[model samples]
Target: MIELRSLTKNFEDKKVLRGINSVFEGGKCNLIIGRSGSGKTVLMKCIVGLLTPTTGNVFYDERDFCVMTKRERTLLRREMGMIFQSAALFDSLTVLENVMFPLDMFSDQSYKERTRRAKYCLERVGLLDALSKSPGEISGGMQKRVAIARAIALEPKYLFCDEPNSGLDPKTSLVIDELIYSITQETGTTTIMNTHDMNSVLGIGDHILYLHEGEKEWEGTKDEVLGSTNERLSDFIFASDFLKKVKAAGAKS
Candidate 1:
Protein backbone atom coordinates (compact mmCIF):
# COMPACT_ATOMS: atom_id res chain seq x y z
CA MET A 1 0.00 0.00 0.00
CA ILE A 2 1.05 3.62 -0.65
CA GLU A 3 0.16 6.45 1.69
CA LEU A 4 0.45 10.20 1.30
CA ARG A 5 0.84 12.15 4.50
CA SER A 6 0.03 15.85 4.43
CA LEU A 7 1.24 15.99 0.86
CA THR A 8 1.71 19.54 -0.40
CA LYS A 9 3.43 20.87 -3.50
CA ASN A 10 4.20 24.38 -4.69
CA PHE A 11 5.41 25.83 -7.95
CA GLU A 12 7.33 28.81 -6.64
CA ASP A 13 4.40 31.09 -5.86
CA LYS A 14 1.44 28.83 -6.59
CA LYS A 15 0.55 25.89 -4.41
CA VAL A 16 -0.68 22.95 -6.48
CA LEU A 17 -1.36 20.45 -3.73
CA ARG A 18 -2.38 21.36 -0.18
CA GLY A 19 -2.03 18.97 2.66
CA ILE A 20 -3.59 16.16 0.64
CA ASN A 21 -3.70 12.94 2.59
CA SER A 22 -4.80 9.63 1.13
CA VAL A 23 -4.11 5.91 1.08
CA PHE A 24 -3.81 3.82 -2.05
CA GLU A 25 -4.43 0.23 -1.11
CA GLY A 26 -2.66 -2.62 -2.87
CA GLY A 27 -4.36 -4.97 -5.35
CA LYS A 28 -6.94 -2.30 -6.14
CA CYS A 29 -7.39 0.22 -8.94
CA ASN A 30 -6.99 3.52 -7.11
CA LEU A 31 -8.21 6.43 -9.24
CA ILE A 32 -7.31 10.11 -8.95
CA ILE A 33 -10.14 11.94 -10.66
CA GLY A 34 -10.76 15.64 -11.18
CA ARG A 35 -11.21 18.25 -13.86
CA SER A 36 -8.23 19.63 -15.70
CA GLY A 37 -6.04 21.89 -13.50
CA SER A 38 -7.30 20.16 -10.37
CA GLY A 39 -3.70 19.14 -9.61
CA LYS A 40 -4.17 15.42 -10.21
CA THR A 41 -1.21 15.35 -12.58
CA VAL A 42 1.01 17.17 -10.08
CA LEU A 43 0.05 14.77 -7.30
CA MET A 44 0.76 11.68 -9.43
CA LYS A 45 4.12 13.11 -10.49
CA CYS A 46 5.04 13.78 -6.88
CA ILE A 47 4.06 10.27 -5.82
CA VAL A 48 6.16 8.78 -8.63
CA GLY A 49 9.11 11.00 -7.62
CA LEU A 50 9.05 13.08 -10.78
CA LEU A 51 8.35 16.17 -8.69
CA THR A 52 9.49 16.99 -5.19
CA PRO A 53 6.80 17.89 -2.70
CA THR A 54 7.33 21.14 -0.92
CA THR A 55 6.17 19.52 2.30
CA GLY A 56 4.93 16.05 3.23
CA ASN A 57 5.86 12.41 3.05
CA VAL A 58 5.19 9.85 0.34
CA PHE A 59 5.46 6.34 1.71
CA TYR A 60 5.78 3.35 -0.58
CA ASP A 61 4.61 0.39 1.48
CA GLU A 62 5.88 2.28 4.55
CA ARG A 63 9.25 3.49 3.17
CA ASP A 64 9.54 7.29 2.87
CA PHE A 65 10.39 8.06 -0.74
CA CYS A 66 11.45 11.64 -0.06
CA VAL A 67 14.34 10.65 2.19
CA MET A 68 15.67 7.62 0.28
CA THR A 69 19.26 7.81 -0.96
CA LYS A 70 19.90 8.08 -4.68
CA ARG A 71 20.92 4.42 -4.93
CA GLU A 72 17.99 3.34 -2.81
CA ARG A 73 15.65 5.44 -4.91
CA THR A 74 17.05 3.92 -8.08
CA LEU A 75 16.41 0.47 -6.65
CA LEU A 76 12.88 1.51 -5.73
CA ARG A 77 12.27 2.63 -9.32
CA ARG A 78 12.74 -0.97 -10.49
CA GLU A 79 9.74 -1.89 -8.38
CA MET A 80 7.58 0.76 -10.09
CA GLY A 81 6.05 1.01 -13.57
CA MET A 82 4.42 3.88 -15.45
CA ILE A 83 2.06 4.20 -18.41
CA PHE A 84 1.97 7.67 -19.88
CA GLN A 85 -0.83 9.56 -21.64
CA SER A 86 0.75 9.07 -25.08
CA ALA A 87 1.58 5.36 -24.56
CA ALA A 88 5.29 6.44 -24.75
CA LEU A 89 6.58 3.45 -26.73
CA PHE A 90 9.77 3.89 -28.68
CA ASP A 91 8.97 4.35 -32.36
CA SER A 92 12.41 3.01 -33.31
CA LEU A 93 11.86 -0.30 -31.54
CA THR A 94 9.46 -3.13 -32.24
CA VAL A 95 6.69 -3.99 -29.76
CA LEU A 96 8.75 -6.80 -28.22
CA GLU A 97 11.81 -4.60 -27.90
CA ASN A 98 9.78 -1.88 -26.20
CA VAL A 99 8.45 -4.41 -23.71
CA MET A 100 11.97 -5.70 -23.10
CA PHE A 101 13.49 -2.26 -22.65
CA PRO A 102 13.13 -2.14 -18.86
CA LEU A 103 14.44 -5.64 -18.37
CA ASP A 104 17.35 -4.87 -20.67
CA MET A 105 18.16 -1.72 -18.73
CA PHE A 106 17.67 -3.07 -15.20
CA SER A 107 17.66 -6.85 -15.15
CA ASP A 108 20.88 -8.88 -14.93
CA GLN A 109 19.14 -11.68 -16.85
CA SER A 110 20.67 -13.11 -20.02
CA TYR A 111 19.30 -12.25 -23.46
CA LYS A 112 17.27 -15.45 -23.63
CA GLU A 113 15.82 -14.89 -20.14
CA ARG A 114 14.87 -11.28 -20.87
CA THR A 115 13.27 -12.30 -24.16
CA ARG A 116 11.29 -15.01 -22.38
CA ARG A 117 10.02 -12.55 -19.77
CA ALA A 118 9.12 -9.95 -22.41
CA LYS A 119 7.31 -12.57 -24.45
CA TYR A 120 5.29 -13.63 -21.43
CA CYS A 121 4.22 -10.04 -20.73
CA LEU A 122 3.35 -9.41 -24.37
CA GLU A 123 1.28 -12.58 -24.39
CA ARG A 124 -0.45 -11.50 -21.22
CA VAL A 125 -1.55 -8.30 -22.95
CA GLY A 126 -2.66 -10.26 -26.05
CA LEU A 127 0.12 -8.96 -28.29
CA LEU A 128 1.89 -12.19 -29.29
CA ASP A 129 1.34 -11.58 -33.00
CA ALA A 130 2.53 -7.97 -32.90
CA LEU A 131 5.92 -8.53 -31.21
CA SER A 132 7.91 -7.70 -34.31
CA LYS A 133 5.74 -4.75 -35.28
CA SER A 134 6.90 -1.26 -34.37
CA PRO A 135 4.76 1.11 -32.30
CA GLY A 136 3.90 3.14 -35.42
CA GLU A 137 2.40 0.08 -37.09
CA ILE A 138 -0.22 -0.50 -34.40
CA SER A 139 -3.50 1.23 -33.64
CA GLY A 140 -3.69 3.64 -30.70
CA GLY A 141 -5.40 1.07 -28.50
CA MET A 142 -2.80 -1.51 -29.43
CA GLN A 143 -0.07 1.00 -28.61
CA LYS A 144 -1.58 1.40 -25.17
CA ARG A 145 -1.53 -2.37 -24.82
CA VAL A 146 2.16 -2.37 -25.68
CA ALA A 147 2.70 0.29 -23.01
CA ILE A 148 0.82 -1.86 -20.50
CA ALA A 149 2.90 -4.88 -21.53
CA ARG A 150 6.09 -2.90 -21.01
CA ALA A 151 4.88 -1.57 -17.66
CA ILE A 152 4.33 -5.09 -16.35
CA ALA A 153 7.43 -6.63 -17.93
CA LEU A 154 9.39 -6.26 -14.71
CA GLU A 155 6.54 -7.42 -12.48
CA PRO A 156 6.49 -4.04 -10.73
CA LYS A 157 4.97 -3.70 -7.28
CA TYR A 158 3.42 -0.29 -8.07
CA LEU A 159 1.78 0.92 -11.29
CA PHE A 160 1.02 4.49 -12.33
CA CYS A 161 -1.07 5.52 -15.33
CA ASP A 162 -1.63 9.06 -16.58
CA GLU A 163 -4.84 9.58 -18.54
CA PRO A 164 -4.41 6.05 -19.91
CA ASN A 165 -7.45 6.11 -22.19
CA SER A 166 -6.80 9.49 -23.72
CA GLY A 167 -7.82 9.84 -27.41
CA LEU A 168 -9.34 6.34 -27.66
CA ASP A 169 -12.94 5.77 -28.71
CA PRO A 170 -15.39 4.82 -25.96
CA LYS A 171 -15.36 1.12 -26.82
CA THR A 172 -11.57 1.02 -27.00
CA SER A 173 -11.33 2.99 -23.77
CA LEU A 174 -13.41 0.39 -21.94
CA VAL A 175 -11.21 -2.36 -23.33
CA ILE A 176 -8.07 -0.66 -21.99
CA ASP A 177 -9.73 -0.11 -18.63
CA GLU A 178 -10.55 -3.79 -18.29
CA LEU A 179 -7.03 -4.76 -19.33
CA ILE A 180 -5.46 -2.49 -16.67
CA TYR A 181 -7.94 -3.66 -14.04
CA SER A 182 -7.18 -7.32 -14.76
CA ILE A 183 -3.45 -6.77 -14.60
CA THR A 184 -3.68 -4.92 -11.28
CA GLN A 185 -5.79 -7.72 -9.78
CA GLU A 186 -3.68 -10.57 -11.13
CA THR A 187 -0.37 -9.05 -10.11
CA GLY A 188 -1.60 -7.42 -6.88
CA THR A 189 0.18 -4.19 -7.79
CA THR A 190 -0.65 -0.90 -6.11
CA THR A 191 -2.19 0.79 -9.17
CA ILE A 192 -2.84 4.52 -9.16
CA MET A 193 -4.35 6.15 -12.26
CA ASN A 194 -4.65 9.89 -12.89
CA THR A 195 -7.60 10.42 -15.17
CA HIS A 196 -10.68 12.47 -15.91
CA ASP A 197 -12.39 9.50 -17.57
CA MET A 198 -15.67 8.95 -15.75
CA ASN A 199 -16.10 5.60 -17.48
CA SER A 200 -12.91 4.43 -15.83
CA VAL A 201 -14.12 5.82 -12.52
CA LEU A 202 -17.29 3.72 -12.62
CA GLY A 203 -15.67 0.76 -14.35
CA ILE A 204 -12.46 -0.03 -12.43
CA GLY A 205 -12.19 2.62 -9.70
CA ASP A 206 -12.22 0.48 -6.55
CA HIS A 207 -10.96 3.54 -4.69
CA ILE A 208 -11.56 7.08 -5.91
CA LEU A 209 -9.75 10.27 -4.86
CA TYR A 210 -11.44 13.44 -5.99
CA LEU A 211 -9.41 16.61 -6.14
CA HIS A 212 -10.64 20.18 -6.46
CA GLU A 213 -8.19 22.97 -7.03
CA GLY A 214 -5.31 21.95 -4.74
CA GLU A 215 -7.01 19.90 -2.05
CA LYS A 216 -8.73 16.54 -1.78
CA GLU A 217 -12.45 17.19 -2.19
CA TRP A 218 -13.56 13.66 -1.42
CA GLU A 219 -12.65 9.99 -1.50
CA GLY A 220 -14.76 6.83 -1.77
CA THR A 221 -15.60 3.74 -3.78
CA LYS A 222 -17.36 3.89 -7.16
CA ASP A 223 -20.71 2.75 -5.75
CA GLU A 224 -20.62 5.41 -3.09
CA VAL A 225 -19.82 8.03 -5.72
CA LEU A 226 -23.25 7.82 -7.34
CA GLY A 227 -24.88 8.64 -4.01
CA SER A 228 -22.30 11.17 -2.88
CA THR A 229 -23.73 14.13 -1.04
CA ASN A 230 -20.72 16.32 -1.84
CA GLU A 231 -22.16 18.94 -4.14
CA ARG A 232 -18.88 19.80 -5.80
CA LEU A 233 -18.20 16.17 -6.56
CA SER A 234 -21.75 15.72 -7.85
CA ASP A 235 -21.41 18.77 -10.05
CA PHE A 236 -18.08 17.67 -11.42
CA ILE A 237 -19.05 14.04 -12.01
CA PHE A 238 -22.63 14.39 -13.18
CA ALA A 239 -22.01 17.42 -15.33
CA SER A 240 -23.98 16.26 -18.34
CA ASP A 241 -27.72 15.76 -18.37
CA PHE A 242 -27.16 12.20 -19.50
CA LEU A 243 -24.82 11.50 -16.58
CA LYS A 244 -27.16 13.22 -14.14
CA LYS A 245 -29.95 10.90 -15.26
CA VAL A 246 -27.69 7.91 -14.85
CA LYS A 247 -26.83 8.98 -11.34
CA ALA A 248 -30.48 9.60 -10.55
CA ALA A 249 -31.44 6.17 -11.83
CA GLY A 250 -28.60 4.58 -9.86
CA ALA A 251 -29.77 6.35 -6.74
CA LYS A 252 -33.35 5.22 -7.29
CA SER A 253 -32.25 1.62 -7.59
Candidate 2:
Protein backbone atom coordinates (compact mmCIF):
# COMPACT_ATOMS: atom_id res chain seq x y z
CA MET A 1 0.00 0.00 0.00
CA ILE A 2 1.02 3.63 -0.58
CA GLU A 3 -0.12 6.75 1.28
CA LEU A 4 0.26 10.41 0.46
CA ARG A 5 0.08 13.13 3.10
CA SER A 6 -0.57 16.70 1.99
CA LEU A 7 1.39 16.23 -1.20
CA THR A 8 2.31 19.26 -3.31
CA LYS A 9 4.66 20.10 -6.19
CA ASN A 10 5.76 23.41 -7.70
CA PHE A 11 7.67 24.10 -10.90
CA GLU A 12 9.50 27.34 -10.23
CA ASP A 13 6.40 29.53 -9.90
CA LYS A 14 3.76 27.24 -11.39
CA LYS A 15 2.15 24.79 -8.99
CA VAL A 16 1.67 21.34 -10.50
CA LEU A 17 0.05 19.60 -7.54
CA ARG A 18 -1.79 20.92 -4.51
CA GLY A 19 -2.20 19.52 -1.04
CA ILE A 20 -3.44 16.11 -2.15
CA ASN A 21 -3.94 13.15 0.14
CA SER A 22 -4.93 9.64 -0.85
CA VAL A 23 -4.34 5.97 -0.18
CA PHE A 24 -3.55 3.38 -2.88
CA GLU A 25 -4.41 -0.05 -1.61
CA GLY A 26 -2.55 -3.19 -2.61
CA GLY A 27 -4.03 -6.00 -4.72
CA LYS A 28 -6.04 -3.44 -6.70
CA CYS A 29 -5.66 -1.10 -9.66
CA ASN A 30 -5.40 2.48 -8.38
CA LEU A 31 -5.79 4.94 -11.26
CA ILE A 32 -5.01 8.62 -11.70
CA ILE A 33 -7.01 10.38 -14.43
CA GLY A 34 -7.56 13.94 -15.61
CA ARG A 35 -7.30 16.37 -18.50
CA SER A 36 -4.02 16.96 -20.33
CA GLY A 37 -2.84 19.72 -17.99
CA SER A 38 -4.51 18.44 -14.82
CA GLY A 39 -1.25 17.17 -13.28
CA LYS A 40 -1.87 13.45 -13.17
CA THR A 41 1.57 12.76 -14.65
CA VAL A 42 3.24 15.06 -12.15
CA LEU A 43 1.49 13.37 -9.26
CA MET A 44 2.59 9.90 -10.47
CA LYS A 45 6.16 11.09 -10.84
CA CYS A 46 6.24 12.44 -7.28
CA ILE A 47 4.88 9.20 -5.87
CA VAL A 48 7.52 7.15 -7.72
CA GLY A 49 10.41 9.41 -6.61
CA LEU A 50 11.05 10.67 -10.16
CA LEU A 51 10.10 14.12 -8.89
CA THR A 52 10.38 15.56 -5.37
CA PRO A 53 7.35 16.87 -3.53
CA THR A 54 7.60 20.42 -2.34
CA THR A 55 5.95 19.77 1.01
CA GLY A 56 4.51 16.41 2.06
CA ASN A 57 5.28 12.81 2.70
CA VAL A 58 5.04 9.70 0.52
CA PHE A 59 5.01 6.40 2.34
CA TYR A 60 5.50 2.98 0.81
CA ASP A 61 3.94 0.38 3.08
CA GLU A 62 4.48 2.92 5.91
CA ARG A 63 8.11 3.71 5.09
CA ASP A 64 8.67 7.45 4.51
CA PHE A 65 10.17 7.78 1.01
CA CYS A 66 11.18 11.44 1.31
CA VAL A 67 13.76 10.85 4.00
CA MET A 68 15.38 7.71 2.62
CA THR A 69 19.10 7.78 1.83
CA LYS A 70 20.28 7.43 -1.77
CA ARG A 71 21.36 3.83 -1.27
CA GLU A 72 18.13 3.07 0.55
CA ARG A 73 16.07 4.57 -2.26
CA THR A 74 18.04 2.58 -4.83
CA LEU A 75 17.40 -0.62 -2.94
CA LEU A 76 13.74 0.25 -2.59
CA ARG A 77 13.51 0.81 -6.36
CA ARG A 78 14.51 -2.79 -6.98
CA GLU A 79 11.21 -3.80 -5.43
CA MET A 80 9.20 -1.61 -7.85
CA GLY A 81 8.37 -2.24 -11.51
CA MET A 82 7.44 0.31 -14.17
CA ILE A 83 5.78 0.22 -17.62
CA PHE A 84 6.06 3.30 -19.77
CA GLN A 85 3.55 4.89 -22.17
CA SER A 86 5.57 3.39 -24.96
CA ALA A 87 6.50 -0.30 -24.73
CA ALA A 88 10.10 0.87 -24.29
CA LEU A 89 11.61 -2.43 -25.39
CA PHE A 90 15.04 -2.48 -26.96
CA ASP A 91 14.89 -3.19 -30.67
CA SER A 92 18.24 -4.94 -30.57
CA LEU A 93 17.15 -7.51 -27.98
CA THR A 94 14.82 -10.51 -28.34
CA VAL A 95 11.56 -10.59 -26.36
CA LEU A 96 12.92 -13.18 -23.91
CA GLU A 97 16.16 -11.22 -23.51
CA ASN A 98 14.17 -8.06 -22.70
CA VAL A 99 12.35 -9.90 -19.92
CA MET A 100 15.59 -11.31 -18.60
CA PHE A 101 17.32 -7.91 -18.49
CA PRO A 102 16.20 -7.00 -14.97
CA LEU A 103 17.10 -10.38 -13.54
CA ASP A 104 20.56 -10.21 -15.04
CA MET A 105 21.12 -6.70 -13.72
CA PHE A 106 19.79 -7.12 -10.16
CA SER A 107 19.13 -10.73 -9.22
CA ASP A 108 21.83 -12.95 -7.67
CA GLN A 109 20.25 -15.98 -9.39
CA SER A 110 22.32 -18.13 -11.74
CA TYR A 111 21.97 -17.76 -15.54
CA LYS A 112 19.83 -20.87 -15.81
CA GLU A 113 17.52 -19.63 -13.06
CA ARG A 114 17.16 -16.24 -14.78
CA THR A 115 16.33 -17.96 -18.07
CA ARG A 116 13.69 -20.07 -16.36
CA ARG A 117 12.19 -17.00 -14.67
CA ALA A 118 12.08 -15.03 -17.91
CA LYS A 119 10.38 -17.86 -19.76
CA TYR A 120 7.85 -18.18 -16.97
CA CYS A 121 6.96 -14.49 -17.17
CA LEU A 122 6.59 -14.72 -20.94
CA GLU A 123 4.35 -17.72 -20.58
CA ARG A 124 2.25 -15.88 -18.04
CA VAL A 125 1.66 -13.12 -20.58
CA GLY A 126 0.91 -15.72 -23.25
CA LEU A 127 3.87 -14.64 -25.32
CA LEU A 128 6.14 -17.67 -25.14
CA ASP A 129 5.93 -18.07 -28.91
CA ALA A 130 7.37 -14.61 -29.43
CA LEU A 131 10.47 -15.24 -27.33
CA SER A 132 13.00 -14.95 -30.11
CA LYS A 133 11.40 -12.02 -31.96
CA SER A 134 12.73 -8.47 -31.69
CA PRO A 135 10.49 -5.54 -30.74
CA GLY A 136 10.50 -4.31 -34.36
CA GLU A 137 8.97 -7.54 -35.59
CA ILE A 138 5.87 -7.51 -33.42
CA SER A 139 2.59 -5.60 -33.44
CA GLY A 140 2.01 -2.75 -30.99
CA GLY A 141 -0.17 -4.87 -28.75
CA MET A 142 2.35 -7.68 -28.71
CA GLN A 143 5.08 -5.19 -27.84
CA LYS A 144 3.03 -3.96 -24.92
CA ARG A 145 2.60 -7.53 -23.75
CA VAL A 146 6.36 -7.99 -23.87
CA ALA A 147 6.74 -4.83 -21.81
CA ILE A 148 4.34 -6.21 -19.22
CA ALA A 149 6.28 -9.48 -19.09
CA ARG A 150 9.50 -7.57 -18.52
CA ALA A 151 7.99 -5.44 -15.77
CA ILE A 152 6.80 -8.48 -13.82
CA ALA A 153 9.93 -10.57 -14.35
CA LEU A 154 11.31 -9.36 -11.05
CA GLU A 155 8.12 -10.22 -9.16
CA PRO A 156 7.94 -6.70 -7.80
CA LYS A 157 5.89 -5.71 -4.77
CA TYR A 158 4.67 -2.54 -6.53
CA LEU A 159 3.81 -1.83 -10.18
CA PHE A 160 3.46 1.48 -11.97
CA CYS A 161 1.98 1.80 -15.45
CA ASP A 162 1.81 5.04 -17.45
CA GLU A 163 -0.88 4.80 -20.13
CA PRO A 164 -0.42 1.08 -20.58
CA ASN A 165 -3.19 1.00 -23.16
CA SER A 166 -1.98 3.89 -25.24
CA GLY A 167 -1.58 3.55 -29.03
CA LEU A 168 -3.69 0.43 -29.38
CA ASP A 169 -7.06 -0.52 -30.85
CA PRO A 170 -10.03 -0.75 -28.46
CA LYS A 171 -9.82 -4.53 -28.44
CA THR A 172 -6.12 -4.51 -27.67
CA SER A 173 -6.67 -1.86 -25.01
CA LEU A 174 -9.12 -4.08 -23.19
CA VAL A 175 -6.66 -6.97 -23.34
CA ILE A 176 -3.96 -4.88 -21.68
CA ASP A 177 -6.39 -3.64 -19.05
CA GLU A 178 -7.48 -7.15 -18.10
CA LEU A 179 -3.88 -8.33 -18.03
CA ILE A 180 -2.82 -5.58 -15.63
CA TYR A 181 -5.83 -6.13 -13.40
CA SER A 182 -5.26 -9.87 -13.23
CA ILE A 183 -1.56 -9.48 -12.52
CA THR A 184 -2.24 -7.08 -9.68
CA GLN A 185 -4.73 -9.45 -8.06
CA GLU A 186 -2.54 -12.49 -8.56
CA THR A 187 0.59 -10.92 -7.09
CA GLY A 188 -1.07 -8.58 -4.58
CA THR A 189 1.08 -5.78 -5.92
CA THR A 190 0.35 -2.16 -5.15
CA THR A 191 -0.52 -1.07 -8.71
CA ILE A 192 -0.86 2.59 -9.66
CA MET A 193 -1.55 3.75 -13.20
CA ASN A 194 -1.65 7.19 -14.80
CA THR A 195 -4.04 7.16 -17.74
CA HIS A 196 -6.52 9.28 -19.66
CA ASP A 197 -8.37 6.35 -21.22
CA MET A 198 -11.99 6.32 -20.09
CA ASN A 199 -12.33 2.67 -21.07
CA SER A 200 -9.60 1.90 -18.55
CA VAL A 201 -11.33 4.08 -15.95
CA LEU A 202 -14.46 1.92 -16.02
CA GLY A 203 -12.71 -1.34 -16.90
CA ILE A 204 -10.20 -1.81 -14.05
CA GLY A 205 -10.13 1.32 -11.94
CA ASP A 206 -10.58 -0.15 -8.47
CA HIS A 207 -9.81 3.29 -7.04
CA ILE A 208 -9.92 6.49 -9.05
CA LEU A 209 -8.35 9.85 -8.33
CA TYR A 210 -9.61 12.78 -10.41
CA LEU A 211 -7.40 15.83 -10.58
CA HIS A 212 -8.43 19.26 -11.83
CA GLU A 213 -6.07 22.18 -12.24
CA GLY A 214 -3.44 20.71 -9.97
CA GLU A 215 -5.91 19.85 -7.20
CA LYS A 216 -7.54 16.58 -6.29
CA GLU A 217 -11.09 17.30 -7.36
CA TRP A 218 -12.58 13.90 -6.59
CA GLU A 219 -11.84 10.30 -5.69
CA GLY A 220 -14.01 7.19 -5.77
CA THR A 221 -14.54 3.72 -7.16
CA LYS A 222 -15.62 3.06 -10.77
CA ASP A 223 -19.15 2.13 -9.68
CA GLU A 224 -19.60 5.54 -8.06
CA VAL A 225 -18.35 7.52 -11.07
CA LEU A 226 -21.57 7.51 -13.07
CA GLY A 227 -23.64 8.44 -10.03
CA SER A 228 -21.35 11.33 -9.11
CA THR A 229 -22.96 14.75 -9.13
CA ASN A 230 -19.65 16.59 -9.42
CA GLU A 231 -20.12 18.92 -12.39
CA ARG A 232 -16.55 18.73 -13.60
CA LEU A 233 -16.42 14.97 -13.37
CA SER A 234 -19.71 14.60 -15.23
CA ASP A 235 -18.46 16.88 -17.97
CA PHE A 236 -15.23 14.98 -18.25
CA ILE A 237 -16.95 11.60 -18.35
CA PHE A 238 -19.39 12.48 -21.09
CA ALA A 239 -17.00 14.58 -23.12
CA SER A 240 -16.65 11.91 -25.79
CA ASP A 241 -19.59 11.49 -28.12
CA PHE A 242 -19.38 7.72 -27.81
CA LEU A 243 -19.87 7.82 -24.05
CA LYS A 244 -22.62 10.41 -24.36
CA LYS A 245 -24.41 8.16 -26.81
CA VAL A 246 -24.02 5.22 -24.50
CA LYS A 247 -25.49 7.21 -21.63
CA ALA A 248 -28.43 8.23 -23.81
CA ALA A 249 -29.02 4.65 -24.92
CA GLY A 250 -28.94 3.50 -21.29
CA ALA A 251 -31.49 6.14 -20.36
CA LYS A 252 -33.76 4.98 -23.20
CA SER A 253 -33.44 1.36 -22.15
Q: Each candidate's lDDT (Cα)? A: 0.95, 0.93
As for candidate 1, its clashing pairs are none
lDDT by residue for model 2 (1-253), tens: 9999999999999999999999999999999999999998889899999999999999999999999999999999998998888889988899999999999999999999999999999998899999999999999999989999999999999999988888899999998999999999999999999888899999899999999998999999999888789999989988999998988898798
CA-only RMSD, every prediction: 1.1, 1.2
Residue-by-residue lDDT tens digits, candidate 1, 99-138: 9999999999999999999999988888899999999999
Lowest summed lDDT over 10 consecutive residues: which window, candidate 1?
244-253
Compared with the true structure, model 2 gives a TM-score of 0.97
Query: What C-alpha lDDT, on a 0 to 100 scale, does residue 155 get in candidate 1?
Result: 94
Model 1 TM-score, 2 decimals = 0.97
- Once superposed on the true structure, which residue ranges of model 1 sit more than 4 Å away at CA? 251-253
Worst window of 10 by summed lDDT in candidate 2? 244-253
